[model samples]
Target chain A: MLDYKLLDALVAVIETGGFERAGSELGLSQSAVSQRIKLLEARLGQPVLVRSPVLQATPAGQRLLNHAQQVQLLERSLSRTIPALNADRTRLRIALNADSLATWWADAIGEFCREEGLLLDLVIEDQDIGLRRMRDGDVAACLCSSDTPVAGARCVRLGQMTYRALARPDYLRQHFPEGLTPAAFRDAPAIVFGPHDQLQHRFLAQQGYHGRFPFHLCPSSEGFVRLALAGMGYGMIPDHQSLGEVKAGRLADLAPGEGIAVDLYWHYWRHGGDFMERLTTTLTRKAQGCLTV
Target chain B: MLDYKLLDALVAVIETGGFERAGSELGLSQSAVSQRIKLLEARLGQPVLVRSPVLQATPAGQRLLNHAQQVQLLERSLSRTIPALNADRTRLRIALNADSLATWWADAIGEFCREEGLLLDLVIEDQDIGLRRMRDGDVAACLCSSDTPVAGARCVRLGQMTYRALARPDYLRQHFPEGLTPAAFRDAPAIVFGPHDQLQHRFLAQQGYHGRFPFHLCPSSEGFVRLALAGMGYGMIPDHQSLGEVKAGRLADLAPGEGIAVDLYWHYWRHGGDFMERLTTTLTRKAQGCLTV
Candidate 1:
């Protein structure tokens, strides 16, 4: 088994970007930190850090870093469960998309972390690709829209996040003065999440309008909504986001009852660590409460 | 020179995730798209797409995608500038952080995209590391804190984004009822952007307090501010985000005039694009107007 102290040093070095900053975090001298890493490399039979342009962990080092972080999370949960050993708030690193981070997941995560006395370390990326980070051990768990599980991980259905195809009343009036049609889709602009974000594209494909689509890409969950609100383009708006505007008729749901629902899944490491279950449970409970059943 | 049609087919295959989807985007049969990719690969003597559990571009493929996208962007700009040739709006992929997206950058980009009749495809990531995507040809340009230019990219100073360490009035009264101290930092929660995000830790280090610091991670720009407002933790709030709230004394700036100012830069490709200069100029002008120069 690899020495955890070595792994800790490796993680710190990669995270802080250098031995000096890592030394500061670990409360060790720069030479002391360097010695630990060297010792680690001696045992592992390979250099862990690449230090030319900038300091970063090698692929092997990243795996170790992710493992060490997982162990740290487990220890925190152990302390919480035992209620005897000195409780240490460990960092629980999780990956998620921008939309979920901005929506229901934020509060639910905060509440769980506070109660368990754990520190959260989130890795935000596109939902379709967020699982890739988890697979590479960049994060312990991930919240993704993909229902299909990767090998060595457990997937739990967190219910569907319904998205209504919405546009400002003025946008529909100006673009499709007659009504929505396949020809209108070619002319009118559409709001997309990002390049890799396939939600908007998939929605269009589901609508059976297969042609060259004009679209504007907006990054944030809120930013996309604002762009759609300004009548820049019609977009798939998450149903739970805003009730007031839709109810007030500020935005029109082009296809009522035809809301495209993306079923979300919480995928976590199947083995190792006690906190993953608790974290997963809390996220699922809170997510189900917020999402469409 | 590679056939633009084949390159377009390759790009569509990678971005849209599969041959069928790319076929739909390009208005061609799946076999036709596949044939184009095969022809391109035959000329290059390498496979571009990694067909497996997921569809993604090979390193060589990413380079070609970036080049083709750049060409498409330039052609669109040429059409706009010339006005005689019919212009087709193409996606202009750029990388930036979420904080900038939520703040003043969003509107500025929107205006520019509209004026140029171009589609915006933003690759959202942290400013410090977003430059990695630029180097990989994933984006035409990136808004980053790094002043050091990459080999082929030109960097322009966009001014400093000042961040005040702030919290809700009530959080201050409850946690550090006495005042700010080293002990208080150890106990009180602080909001962080993400795992790779070192802003909060760096702030604490600069404050001359180096110990095990407690922090809560919130990914989104607005989400973290909201959490800070909800008294979850004191965060480094970007100054331009809400001057009114700080002015009204709702969110207390824990350290006045001690705000951390991260200098921002616009780094882009030096050649093969006409609109990049315009985009960079508009961004720099708007950013300088809003940031602390």
Candidate 2:
């Protein structure tokens, strides 16, 4: 059996980003934490961490973290079933895309968390890349656009987020006076969410503009909307999020009839137990109400 | 002297994240891009990239990237001075925290960008850690909470963001009935922006509570506010961000008199030339109007 004490030391070190902080969090001396890591490496016959430049998990370390997270979830399931075993509330670490988190995620999970006495540790990532968190074993579950599940995990399709190329009326008037022609796209700037976000590029390509274009990259979902509202640039804004602005006539679709439907999926461990199952059910039902099916 | 062609290849590879994508962006074959990287590395007598799990720059590569970025900025300055030299617009990559971007940054920079015909490539990071992006040579500038500048960089104090522990009325009534006693805080869940966020920890410590308390880590600045407004948890929210919610009675301060003040700074390359200097002036002048000085 793997030594959980050693595994816990590894988890603490990775989570806190350093040995010193891990020691403080775990109530162990710095040297003691280092010794435990060494012992764990010796037992495994491989190095679990890379200590130079930055503390990161090696491939071996990631696998161990995945195992440790699964064990923690199972333990939490037991505690929940037998409330006398533990009085502390349960906390689940999840990797979620910023768009969902900004729009319907909180509402979807609020009542479930309150009723179950649960807390969340949410890691924000781009929907296109959130699954890497699942692969790296950093999060127990993730909400991403990828439908495929990682090894030892299961995925369920939740709903779809419909995104339209949207901008303020003035932005269209100033930049795309002739309306989204390839020639106009050459000079007009667009807004991209970030480096990993390809929505704008894809949207433009679909609109028959394949040339290089200038853009403003804004990472915050709310900030993305705000930038468009401020007449900075046209961008792909989800219908769920842009409803108020659209209704207020603050935003207009650059390409009125066209939109990209991104399907969202909930990826979690196959054996994540009763809590994960219940939470998934609640999320699916709530998300269905707000998102396009 | 380093060849500009080789340097461009290095920059494109790192910016696009792979030789394949870099090739597509630069209109070269993948092998041609690879040969350029090899030629660049041979000239430097070192490896430029680590190409295993992910394609990332080596320490030497980072230094080269910094040089390339400075050259690009200087070139842009020259182009601005002599419009006949280049008709292309200038783009500046910056790392900014979510709070500043959501609240005052866009408004602060919008007019300046439009007037200068510049585009922004924004990388969102925690204020406490944004300086690292400057060190890693990924951005031309950054807005962070750090007062100190990195090597070859200059920093200017912009202003301060004041944060208060705010929660919905029902949340306060249910969780902190006795009003912020250490015992009350032991179980009352708090919301933290992310792992790098220490405002909540500092606030709790200032109130004389040192025990491990439960917290929900919501990374999005707007999502953090939404979670708090949804009666999920109390979080330290900036006055700039929470003004509307407080005015609408959707949120209330847990401790009205006590709040944390985080100073914001603008860090840029010391020799980033005229564009950087003008942006620094505009940001400093506009931030003073909105932020506490």
Candidate 3:
């Protein structure tokens, strides 16, 4: 049988990009690292590393690297979670889009935790960036808008979130009689969430308009909705998030037929604590109820 | 921090159902089991067991039991898979349903393995029962019909499979002109895969017919389709599975509008080797191409 210490040594060398650096980091003699690699190759009956002036990982080494990283992550998770498993303390951490957080995800997580008797830590961020945080081990799970999962992570489609261009009814009435055209959109002010928030920009671009908006940046989803409700500017909002406002005539649809649809996905590390599993289940069920498909 | 030994001790006791039996099995004294359980309870701040005369698991203990079994399975898997990670041995084990094996899964797995320079070990069985084998640490993964994943297993919905009630054209012609009325099906002979196969039963029940069939039992999906093709009896067959026969006029639809729809779910233990991930990705892609939904 190959020694686990040898596997660790090989992984360390691969990760650090050289044997000498790995040895220094692991506090082992350089000869010991070499011997471990040689013995590992002997046990596996094949060479794993491609030794050169600049270290390079062979296909086999790359495969091992993937598994080693997963194992390391699992170990860290086990260390943090096992203590709580034995104790009455059960805390779940989940990353979600601010829109979803303000819309339905909190109620879903709260209801599930209440029934399951769990403590929850909710991390809210933009869906585009939340998935990266999930992959980096910052959060146990996330609800994001991408089907392509990060390497070493798992993903499932929660459902589709449809966005409609909206503004306050008074703003729409003041801005147009024949309805706003592509030419008029350039001069109009818009409320955007952040710099990377290109939903309204994309909707405008699709209509052959390339124009900058006088900006009112509200980073929070609730804040943006409130700003729009107060007749601030035109913006894009998810149907579920803006439905109540639209129904009450506080926010009026700008172009109802031209909506942007982005499907949401639940992404998480392949291996983690039960908190990840519970959160994924709750989010998936809630998304099924809220989204279109 | 939890001592990993405590989890092992709890699992042994649960598996054996007694302190003495678990102690003997783990090569420890009964007092050791008692002491470990006491320590575990103290560390967790709650009792994991309910013991008067008989040993029983509390809800918290049951949760730990699930995690314990997963840890044990993963430990074994790590022992087998970690060493092979950097080995020249190009072998992979894949578990899948017999129907898909006979149809498209085998070719996909074979092509992927060949392209990736891997030797394949295919395990084919009924989709329903095969997942248990995966949970028992026998196989790496499985293609099953469960949407709710097994504890400690990951699941993905491939798509929905639509099965048409199929029969030999001659058999249908001889059986009825009313075209699969409730009366005709009450005494009709049907081909079923084996015991516990309920596709036909459920389809008939939906049409308000409570009747038993003179069943010709064919266990394998290929064999069931063969039996139906040989004019033994009518059976429900997936459109992909029976497409060739249906196109050749060997089989005819008995109730096209009242077909059965079964959504297939792919499941694998969270700690299986890389083969599980590769197989899941390939199977999900292939199923999307083959299934209706």
Candidate 4:
């Protein structure tokens, strides 16, 4: 029931943003792009976008975009399966977060991509949002925070990604000489991944120090640890990157014997070839090996 | 009319994700958390959250969250205005992207933070989505893609980030010897930033090649160029990062004269003290100096 032209227009709007540029990208007039979007919205009986501040998909719009992307994937996979139909190579799009990329996902999956002759398009974003991308059919699969699967997708629990509250020994000595009290937290800056990363929040909350605390915003996961080690601030760093530093006396665990554990899940769509199934098996095993036992 | 207790519960839920966990975070029972959310929703007379596969803010929800965060920022700034209230160091949360942080924003803003006696928390996210955070009152300002300001924000055109179609000379010889034709595109793999980055999409559309092509998933901006140089795939590399390689003959620009230009913008809340104004002046001057004259 979805019109290809209309759907393409909608996608162009979301991708390029704004009607004028979407039209330019589609080689259509701005009015044509606007009219097509309106037609699609009318057909759907719901507004597809919220356009005042910036163009973004409404919930209904997101679902339709998902439908379009799923159709594209189906076509791409079909061409791969039936080489006579078309000769495009198979490229698997998987959504993941920064920590997984900086830690284990890429290395573990790199071999799989080579062996299966599969190209990969890693959609890196917030883990929770990454799974949403899978549900929206933006990516075929995602490694995300949720243990629960999206309606049609399958979910597998990968072991917990352990994050320990870490600080340079000198930072601990200077700021938390009397241990991590509310006053220490107020004085000492903590390095957070970004606005969305809750590792530091959970750590502080668990320690029962709530209120506005000083924090350094370092977006990179690896970079977060680097800053912490450089004595810029305390941070919750993944054990993969921090264990060695902690052992070498370069970094100290702020919360002794206490660590934040986020249980990761691998969620994938129901339909895929043997490659996907093998990937799931491979990914799960590799994660178990690298993550907390 | 909004209850602070209920809002706190909502913030906990948004931060920690699930109801049970959010309850745990707030030191309340799961039922208590659920009731608080339902009460808040009832009071608002509108559904705030789009609860399903992922926990995401609806437009209405985003507005409420923004209001809550704005109140927090107001309180914090009030302390700075009257040092007698609470002598905590003022932290300015600003949202930006990895490219800016990796390239020049950090160096440019470092002096401002030092001079203004401001502790900066940089929230690195997707530029458009980061502006969404600014709209939600999560950050004081953001560097984003929009020329139009969000509701009560101001927009400043920084400059354009130029991206050129780049690959190794060997890659160029193998894939695009006939220039960037449709056939060449189908055969050559491309390195893309992520699912949402449209730099390459704009380039390929300009070339009139609409087929699904093979692509390598490289998430890092600088890393995107590195991978392209490593012969993993051809990609649209940022002009700042690509120029050195192109000059040294280490990389070749496939499209010759053609390039993709994304005009960057700085958006901030309309109302601010001298610090924000000074930052705007400094940032604009610095960007003008480094970016294309």
Weakest ten-residue segment in model 1 chain A by summed lDDT: A106-115
Residue B28 in candidate 4, Cα distance off native in Å: 11
Candidate 3, residues A74-170, lDDT tens digits: the string is: 5545645675534332333456666765555534444554444343335556665576566555556677787888887889998887888898777
Please tell me what DockQ candidate 2 reaches: 0.50
Per-residue error (Å), model 1, residue A269: 4.2
Per-model TM-score, in order, reads: 0.87, 0.90, 0.37, 0.67
- How far residue A235's Cα lies from its native spot in candidate 1, in Å, is 2.2
Taking the tens digit of each residue's C-alpha lDDT, what string does model 3 give over B1-293?
55878876886675455677678657889899889999999999999888742466676886676555445445444645676544332323345654564454533443454344343334555665566566555455567677777788898988877788898898798666677676677555676654446687687777676543344444456546655665656888888778888899989988767788887777777665455566578867866666766
User: How large is the interface RMSD of each prediction?
Assistant: 3.0, 3.2, 32.5, 5.6
lDDT of 1: 0.77
Query: Tens digits of per-residue lDDT for model 2 on B1-293?
Result: 77989988987787666787788768999899999999999989999999754567887897787677678678778987897888446667788988988888877888788777787878787754567778877678999988877999999999999999999999999998888887889788888886556787789789987655667878888899889877899999999989889999999999988989999989998889987898899999988887999
Q: In model 3, what is the error at residue A127, expressed in angstroms? A: 3.5
Full-model lDDT for every candidate = 0.77, 0.83, 0.65, 0.73
- The worst-scoring run of ten residues by lDDT in candidate 3 chain B lies at B85-94
Candidate 2, residue B80: how far the Cα is off, in Å = 4.5
lDDT of 4 at B92: 65
Clash totals in order: 0, 0, 2, 1
lDDT string, candidate 4, B103-215, tens digits: 65655565555454455666667776787677677678888777878898889988878778898898788778888788888767788776566777788889998655667
Q: Cα deviation in Å at residue A131, candidate 1?
A: 4.1
Best TM-score among the predictions, by candidate number: 2
Best by DockQ: 2
Candidate 4, position B146, lDDT: 72
Native-interface RMSD of candidate 1? 3.0
